[model samples]
Target: MFKINNLSAGIGGKTILKEISLDIKPGQVHAIMGPNGSGKSTMAGVISGNDNYEVTAGELLFDGKDIKDLDPEERACMGVFLAFQYPVSIAGVNNMVFLQASINSIRKYKGLPPLDAFDLIELIKSKMKLINMNPDLLQRGLNDGFSGGEKKRNEILQMLCLEPKLVILDETDSGLDIDAMKAVADGVNAIRDDQRSFIVVTHYQRLLDYIKPDVVHILKDGEIVMSGDYKLALKLEKEGYGWLS
Candidate 1:
């Protein structure tokens, strides 16, 4: 469903992702593990259409189309949902308002009727239950007073409502407790289908214990140094990434 061919990107003339190539197939969960400053986040940003980094070389194709020049919203409209590592808090914007607008926008782009406020409210409640989130969260300002786990669950709630084809989770497990992590993983696992895909970018092997990615990739210095199955995560945990050099 997604392909990155010899992709290279940089910020302010400094390249961060160097000739990285990857293919994410439908219904497959892929995990990318790397140390600090290894450009994993950069890869997510580039795929999400972040304008801060210029594509120095290569092509990014989504669903068999060249989307290298598409804006973030454009990519999102095409069924790409990115659960950010650090979700931004927007004051004065009700959480439900943001969720409804996002869902309506995608529906509009897909030629579906825009959901009215009533339907949106119903949808919000249903998805909140799906992610085991509190309905009270919908009444608050978007991410304003949410704890780390709340913010993460909020991201998952959005994913459930939109039902995107390709989900990019950028360090979604960063700050969760074990139970919270399991909740998040369970939510993700439930949504797995033949038409959907996941790209999980994380630092620890704990999240993998729940998600069980089809492939595990070790990214080093902006490049993929090794690729293996689930056991690779165990290796990285026991031996560390030092041997990846």
Candidate 2:
């Protein structure tokens, strides 16, 4: 459902991704593992149409059409979601209200009527239950003073509400405890279907232990040096990235 061919992207005048090529089929989970500064987040940013980066070369295609020109909101409305490595805390912004507005906006974009307050609340409560989340969180500010695990769960909550076709989780397991990580993985696993695809970028294989990927790619210096099945993640878990260089 997503394809990148000879794609090079960067910020300012520095190119981070060099001729990166990938073909992700529907219902596939592709895990990208790499060292710091390997452009994992940059690639995610570029794919989600972050304006900070510039695409100097190649194609960023979603469903065979280039998405480099689309804005981040456009991509989100088109079934693309990115969970950031560091979730921002917006003070004084009620999370429930914010989520409702965001979901209704996407619905409007799709020419669907906005859901009523009761229906929206019930839907959110149901999703929160799916991830074992505390519904009281809906009353708090958006990630305001939330623990790392809460913030990550909020991202997954958005995923459940948005129901996007392409989900990019950028280190969703970072700073999470074992139980928290499992909860997040369960939320992700619950949403997996034949039409949805995932690009899970992480520094460890432990996350893959719960959300197994169909393919694993080791990225070094902004290039994919190796690609294999789940065994690649296992090997990297046993032996670190030093062996690849």
Please report the candidate that would top TM-score against the real structure: 2
Clashes of each: 0, 0
Q: Model 2 residue 171 lDDT?
A: 94
Q: Tell me the spans in candidate 1 whose CA falls farther than 4 Å from its real position.
A: none
lDDT of each: 0.92, 0.94
In the range 42-159, model 2's lDDT, one tens digit per residue, is 9999999888999999998899889889989999999999999998999899999999999999999999999999999999999999888988889999999898999999999999
- Pairs in steric clash, model 2: none
| Per-residue lDDT of model 1, residues 142-241, tens digit only | 9999999999999999888899999999999998999889888978987999889999999999999999899999988999989999999999999988
Clashing pairs in 1: none
Error of 2 at 14 (Å): 0.7
| Model 1 RMSD in angstroms | 0.9
Error of 1 at 223 (Å): 0.5
Shift of residue 36 alpha carbon in model 1, Å:
0.6
Candidate 2 runs further than 4 Å off: none
Q: Pairing residues by index, what is the TM-score of model 2?
A: 0.98
